[model samples]
Structures are given as structure tokens and as C-alpha cells.
Target: MLQYLTVPVTAFAQNCSIVWCDQTMDAAIIDPGGDLDRLLVEVKRLHLNLQAIWLTHAHIDHAGGTAELAERLQLPIIGPHPGDQFWIDGLAQQSQMFGFPHADPFTPTRWLQDGDSVQIGQSTLAVRHCPGHTPGHVVFHSAEAQRAFVGDVLFAGGIGRTDFPQGNHQQLLDSIKERLWPMGDATVFIPGHGPESTFGHERRFNPYVGTP
Candidate 1:
């Protein structure tokens, strides 16, 4: 079985998740935006073997610590798709703009596509290219666990803002209605910031994209 813990990191309070396969104890950190020391301590406390760094997008609050973490742990940096290359390239500038610590730009070890899958020990997560908040944003879904790490794509009562560079409102909406909704309304999602919510709840109550 797959298990995860959400740790809020950085000034942005981004939800950095530590997901691991219970049977193997192999773990992957999703969106190590910042505060490496704190995240590392949690990893140790949990007695998990850190394996990789998975990204949902290249926004400063979501990917600021990616490069440094990957280098220090010698872990593979994966996902967020190729569309976010420009955002990845501007990590340093983003850090300065957001008043975050200097963030180094990085290249993903493997660029993910919509239909790809990522493995962490005995567990496997399906990758969905969910762009809108950023051109290359993606979400990780664990079917067996019935959970989705949706990054900034969707939220408790709101949806991701499409005001950034390369952001497309229609495309984002489409990704949610098509890629996400199909995952089943009962699935619980972890957003980049704030609390978690179920797709069924969002579909019935979300103001921006709710069916109700």
C-alpha cells in the first residue's frame, strides 16, 4: 500500500508531500518547495529511504527547493512535464521576486507526458498532465489509494489562478473536467496550499468550476 504525509513548507505554506510504499519503505518527496532541513528531519523521523523528487509544476512556491534537494540527495528529479521548462529556467528570478531564498534552476531527469506512470518501490502512480496554473503542471494519482496530489490545479473551494505566464484558463478548465473528473468524484485531492477536498465536494460546491 502507498502512504503519504503532507508537510507545509516555505513562506508560501506549500504542501510538500512525503509519499512512500509501506511494504518497501521507499519514499518520494513531492514538491520540495523550500525548507530542506525540516523536510529532511521528517524523512528521518519516519525512517524512509528518500528515492526521488517529484514536481507538479515549476512555480517558485512549488518547485523552489527541487534543484538543491536533488543534488544533495542525489535523487532523480521527475515530472511536471516539458511545458514547464521556461518556468524551471526562471527559478532564480522567481525566488528574488517572491522574496524566497535563491532557488536554482534544474532539468528534470525525465519529462513526463499525460499517460506516463511513476514508480516508488512497489507502488505506482499515474501521471496526468494538468496544465493551467503553469504550462507544464501535472498531477499524480494513486488509484489504489484513491488520492491525488493535484498541486495548484484545484483547491477546497477554489481553482488555480490562470494569471501566470503561459497560463490558459480554458485549458485548465478542460484538464479538470476531463483529466481530473474522470478519476472519480470520490477521490480526495491534495492541493498546493490550504486543505484537502474531495472531487465530489468540489463538483457540487466549487464556485468557479462546480457543476452544481
Candidate 2:
């Protein structure tokens, strides 16, 4: 079985998930957004081999702790080439600007792209480029588990704000309508913040999506 743990890290209180395959002890971390200590503790407790770090976007709250976790665990950081290169390069400045404590930048070990497949434990995540929150924003889909980690794209009852530099409301809406909505009602939606929701729940009740 593949196990999942969500660790709320950093001052942003982003959810960083520790996903592992019980049989292999192989694991992948999704959005190690902050608080290196908490992530490390969970990794140790589970006796998981940190194989890869996956990012949902380039925002400081989502990718801030990536460098630290990668360096400490000697794991590779992988994510799509953000459409918002400015945000990716300016993570440190963004942190300072937002008063979200300080974080250092480190080059991504690998650039994620649309349709990319990342193997973690016994599962494979199909990368779906879902931008607007940040240029390179994406949602990782695991078909077997019927789950998608949609970072800052579509929240439970609302949607991600596109007020930041490079953020675009239209694009985000399009992304949600075109990419996420097609995932079907049964797909579990795990957003970057707040409680989880199903695609059906969002479609039927999410104020942003509205009734079809």
C-alpha cells in the first residue's frame, strides 16, 4: 500500500506530503514548503528513503524548503519549468517581501514538464501543467490512487488568487475548467492549502466552479 502524510510546514503553513510505498520503503515528498525539522522527523519515523521532491509551483510557500530538504537528504528536486521564471528566480525576494521568514534558492535537480511521469515507490504521477497561480504551477495525478495534488490552483470552496506577479486569473480559470474539471467527479482533490475535496464536490458546491 502507498501511505500518505501531510506535514504543514513553514510560516505559510503549506502542506507537505510524505508519500511512500510500504513494501519498498521508497518515498517521494510533495511540496516540502517549509519547516525542515518536521519533514525530517516524519521521514525518520517512517524509515523512508527520500528519493525525490516534487513541487506544485514556484511560489515561496510551495518550494521554499526544497533546497534544504534536498541537501540534507541528498535527494533530487524535480518540478516543471515554471511559466513564471521570475517567481522561480525571485523566491528569496518574495519571502522577504511577504515577511515569510527567509529561504535560500537552489537550482532544481530536474525540470518538470507537461505529461512527465515520475516514479515514486510503486506509483507513477502524471504531471499536468495547471498554471495561473504561478507560471509553472502543476497538479500531480496518481491514477491508481485516484488523487491529485493541485497546488494553489483550485481550493476547496474557492480558487487561488492571481494577484501576485505573473499570476493570471483568466489563465487559472481556464486551467481549472480545462484540466481539473476533466478529472471526473470521483477524483480526490488535494489543494495546497485548506481541507481536501473531491472533484465532484468542487464541481457541485465550489463557488468558483459553480453549478453546471
Candidate 3:
């Protein structure tokens, strides 16, 4: 079975998740934005063998700690698609702009795309290229767990701000309706910030994209 724990990190309060397979205790840290010491404490507490780092996008709040974390752990970095290469390259600038700790840019060990799958021990998560908030954003869905880790794409009652470089409002809406809605309304999603919400609840109550 797949298990996870969400820990809010950095001033952005980004929801960094620790997902693992219960059988083997093999785990992956998703979106280690910052506060590395805190994240590692939880990993040690859980006694999980950390294997890799998975990224949803390259925003400073979502990927700031990726480079250092990967280097320290000797772990493979994966995903967020190739479109976020520019964002990854600008980590230092982003950190300065946001008053965050200096973030070093990194190259993913493996770039992901739609239809790809990532594994942790015995569990598998399907990857979806959900761009709009960022040209290379992606989401991870675990059919077995009925959960989706959607970074800054959709919220409980709001949506991602498409005002950054290369952002497109219509494209974001399209990605939500086309890429996310198909995951099934019952699927609970872990967003980049705030509390989690079910797709069904968001579809019915989310003012930005809810049905009338």
C-alpha cells in the first residue's frame, strides 16, 4: 500500500509530501522547497529509506531545496517536464526575489511527460503533464491510493495564478478541465498550498471553475 504525509515547508507553506510503499518502506520526497532539516527529521522518524526526489514544477516555493537535497542524499531527481528548464535555471534569481534562501539550479535525472509512471517500492504513480501555471508543470496520480499531487494547478476554491512568465489563463482552465477532471471527482488532491480537497468538492464548489 502507498502511504504519505504532508509537511508544510518554507514561508510559502508549500505542501511537501513524503510518499512511500508500506511494504518496503521505500520513499520519495516530493517538492522539497526548503527547511531541509525539518523534512529530514520526519523521514528519520518514519524510518523510510529515501530513494528519490520528485518535482511537480520548478517554482522557488516548490523546488528551492531540490538541488541541495539531491546532492546530500545522492538521490535521483525526477519530473516537472522539460518546460520548466528555464525556471530551474532561474532558481537563484527566484530565491532572491522571494527573499528565500539561495536556491541552486539543478538538472533532473529524468524529465517526465504525460503517460509516464514513477515507482516507490511496490507502488506506482501515473504522471500527467499539467501545464498552465508553468509551461512544464505536472501532477502525480496514484490510482491505487486514489490521490493526486497537483502542484499549484488547482485549489479547493481557487485556481493557480496564470500571471507569471509564459502563463496563460485559458490554457490553465483547459488543463484543469481536460487533464484533471478525468482523474475522477472522488480523487483527493494535495495542492501546493492550503488544505487538501476532493475533485468532486472542487468541481461543485470551486468558484473559479465550478459548475453553475
Candidate 4:
């Protein structure tokens, strides 16, 4: 069985998910935005052994606490795509620009790619490269679980902004229509923020998807 725990962190309130295989207790941290101590606490409480840290993008609100957490957990950070390398490298500057404490640039131990599988305990998460929110933004999907974690790409009622650095409005739209919309209406959508929704709900009501 697989277990999920959502911890909203940082000023942006990004949802940091801890997903693990129940039997092996092997875990992976998804977008440890901030509050490293709290995340560590949860890890201890769950008695989970940290295996890897995955990032959906390199935004400060999503990867801000990565360096600190990785250092403490003694685990390698894994990025599914390389397009976000600029953002990852400029983390400190981005933090400073936002008036937040600077976050050190974290080097990823491995890069995640489209159609790749990231193992978490017994199951694997399928990577879908959904850019526009960030050049390398990705959504992780588990077919067996029928759940997907979309990091700031699409939300319940809206979609991510394309005004940020390297954000391409057209590409983002294409990504949604081609990559996400085909996931089936029954897929569960676990966004980076706000409440969860189903693909069916978003397809029917989300303004970004038009009045389908």
C-alpha cells in the first residue's frame, strides 16, 4: 500500500507531499518548499527512511528548503528535467528578490525525464513534462493510484501564471491540452496549492480548460 502526507510550507504555501511504500517504509519527499524542521518531524513520526527528494520545478516556493533538508537527511535531490536548471541555480537570487531568506542552490543528483519512472517503495510515478509554469515543470502520476501531483501547472479553478522567468504561455497551454487532458476525467488532481480536485471536475468547470 502507499501512504501520502501533505505538508503546506513556505510563504507560497506549496504542498509538500511525503509519499512512501507502506511495507518497506521507503519514502520520497516531493517539493519540500520550506519548514525543513516540520518535514523532518513528520519523517520521524512516520518512521520513514528517506530515499530521494524530487522537485517538480526549481521555484523558490517549491525547492527553497531542498538544500537544507537534503543536507540533513543525507539524501540526493533528483530533478526530472534540466530546463529548470537556471531557476535552480538562481534560487538564492529569487529568494532575495522576494524578500525571503536566500536559499542555496542545490545540485540535483539525478535528472528526471518525460516518460521516466521514479520508484517510491513498491510503486512508480510516471513523469509528464508539463512546462509553462516553469520550463521544466512536471506532474507525477501513479496509474495504479489514479492520482497526480501537478506542481503549479494547473489548479482547481485556474492555471499557473506565465509571467515568471522562462514561462511560455503558449507552451503551457499546449502542455495542458496534450499532456494532462488525456489523463482521463477520473484522475485525481493534487495541485501545488489549494484543495484537491478530480480531472473530471476541472474539465467541466475550470476556466482555463474553457467551458467543456
Show pairs that collide, candidate 4. Answer: 79-112, 80-112
Residue 198 miss distance in model 1 (angstroms): 0.4
Over 1-212, each residue of candidate 1 has an lDDT whose tens digit, in order, gives 99999999999899999999999999999999999999999999999999999999999998999999999989999988999999999999999999999999988999899989999999999999998888999999999999999999999999899998999999999999999999999999999999999999999999988988
Cα lDDT of model 1 overall?
Answer: 0.95
Sort by lDDT, best first: what order? 3, 1, 4, 2
Q: Write the per-residue lDDT of candidate 3 for residues 67-143, one digit (tens) a residue.
A: 99999999999988999999999999999999999999999999999999999999999999988999999999999
Q: In angstroms, give how far residue 115 of model 2 lies from its true place.
A: 1.1
Q: What global local distance difference test value does model 2 have?
A: 0.82
Question: What local lDDT score does residue 189 receive in model 4, on the 0 to 100 scale?
Answer: 79
- Report lDDT (CA) for all predictions: 0.95, 0.82, 0.95, 0.87
TM-score of 3: 0.99
For each of the candidates, the C-alpha root-mean-square deviation to the true structure, in angstroms, is: 0.6, 1.4, 0.6, 1.1
Task: Look at candidate 1 and give me any clashing residue pairs.
Answer: none
Candidate 4, position 48, lDDT: 94
| Candidate closer to the true structure by TM-score (higher is better), 2 or 4 | 4
Backbone clashes for every candidate come to 0, 6, 0, 2
